[model samples]
Target: MIAQLARKIRYIADPAFDTRDGYGGKLVIALRDGTFIERTEPYHWGSPELPISAHDIYDKFEANTAASHLVGNVGKIISMIAALEDVGRVGDIVELCRREQD
Candidate 1:
């Protein structure tokens, strides 16, 4: 299965793309049907031009942290992070992130 899937996929790097600061340029997808699809994004998503919303951040956090070390503490983490200005001790948040005993 791995070999068959590897044969269907190929990654070709383009030296012309300005990928110095994690910027994504043109992406071309050539399917087996002799058709190609292209997408170009010169700037990163969280950059000035393509700013992300707080909701987007929350969603992404939830997605990435699924079944993580802080499984049941995600809501508390989000709440504390949202009101970070009033959080006097950063260790409180750090404590929540720590995995409990087995």
Candidate 2:
């Protein structure tokens, strides 16, 4: 999948390709075998009735924090936020989010 994504990016980056006016909320892909797939709904899991799971949210949080490397206490932050209802004070979580000195 990663390789395929890289290939697609390369194809898009090619100067010969026409990429103007590419903005769109829908995705339509046409295969070489004369088949195509399309999706019009922008947020599949963003609806209130179909909210994202805690695990999925955590996965996204972890990915963002890891990529940015801006947070030193990710685990503590995740735990604090997960149990925010039981937490005595929100400052405790804020304190844990402080960046560590090198």
Candidate 3:
């Protein structure tokens, strides 16, 4: 099930995510060639159930110098995906994979 979710979110491959660390905070999700799609906490999230938007999550990644060049890539990728949302490929892949999820 996790694998299916991960694959479905592969459109945002290997992007870093912003997370609150004990001391300060950390830019998480580096190794995997995919985006992080975890639910946000109620305290930090506006909706509790669906606080974070896909685009907001993408924006949290740390910019260039160390990791991938995330300076402007976030918006660029989001725009790219937005343009494709009405298309069939992403939906088809997600629907097909979701059928196998258990």
Candidate 4:
């Protein structure tokens, strides 16, 4: 699977991206219609100026864990984390994340 995927992937360097202050990048998706979807990102994100919303954070978590055995605990974990100051023990969160024994 990896070998087949590697053959179709191409890596290239573009002089446009600069890293004086931080890493910069441009993402372009080439479509068959001779058009490209492009986005210019000046640098890495998640700073105070580029804060990630709580909704986006939960969406990412849900997308990654949708197929895992721990799917049942996602809701509870998010709730506990949101009100972390009221949580008596961090162990409660850890227990919900325990891996199923193979």
Candidate 5:
């Protein structure tokens, strides 16, 4: 339920701005068979939902009209997650998720 709501929120918020790729740029996905695949590129980032919470409470709607804005630094966030993965650091990942909740 939360994921569905978040996807609707994201689509309504930014129809043009897709989710991030694993490494850097936003992910462009193929929706089929109730599954999505990342259409990768040379500078691909991770799939969108992978980096964010199952629910995106980001105030995208309110921020849309602002002249200047700051996007959540997802690449850095993913890097931290990757570092945790590389070191077999599950506890750190949990802590990171907790911080994100705050």
Candidate 6:
């Protein structure tokens, strides 16, 4: 999988890359035939142009929490976050993120 990803990926660095325009950084991919493809503005998930689905957010939350070895019911944490608007206190979320004692 790593090899396949490496083969399809390209990276370019520009010393003048800037995001002061609020459009994020630019990405340019130069082709072998001398032409290139470019994106002047970056797409941010959950933004007006590019919106992320709830499932995707939950997937990311699960992946990050698992990788961090956080001790709690991940499903419950996700539920709490999803319903954060109705939550009376923010400390409830903090309690769920506490490390479990061994």
Best-performing candidate as measured by lDDT: 1
lDDT of 6 by residue, 36-80 (tens): 898765545666677889999899888887766563579888888
Q: Candidates 2 and 5: which is better by TM-score? A: 2
Give the better candidate number (2 or 6) by lDDT. 6
Write the candidate numbers in order of decreasing lDDT: 1, 4, 6, 2, 3, 5
Model 5 residue pairs with clashes? 19-27, 20-26, 20-27, 21-45, 21-46, 22-45, 22-46, 23-45, 23-46, 24-45
Tens-digit lDDT string for candidate 2 (1-102): 999876764222433323342322455577889897976543346456357899889888888889554456788789889999989999988777666668
lDDT of 4 by residue, 1-102 (tens): 999967866766667766564466777777789898989777666545467788888888888999997799999988988899999999999988899777
| Model 1: residue 97 alpha-carbon error in angstroms | 0.7
Q: Which stretches of candidate 4 lie above 4 Å from their native place?
A: 1-6, 13-20, 30-37
- TM-score, candidate number 1: 0.81
- Check candidate 3 and list the clashing pairs: 14-34
Query: Over the full model, what C-alpha lDDT does candidate 3 score relative to the true structure?
Result: 0.45
lDDT (Cα, tens digit) per residue for candidate 5, span 1-102: 989856753322333334342343344454556776654333332255344442242334225423422224443335655465574656654454443432
By lDDT, is 2 or 5 better? 2
Model 5 CA deviation exceeding 4 Å by range = 1-73, 83-85, 99-102
TM-score: model 3 vs. ground truth: 0.26
Residue 99 accuracy (lDDT) in model 4: 90
Indicate the worst ten consecutive residues by lDDT in candidate 5: 53-62
The worst-scoring run of ten residues by lDDT in candidate 3 lies at: 18-27
lDDT tens digits, residues 49-93, model 3? 446776565455333222544443444444556677665567543
The whole-model C-alpha lDDT of candidate 4 against the native structure comes to: 0.81
Candidate 5 all-Cα RMSD: 15.0
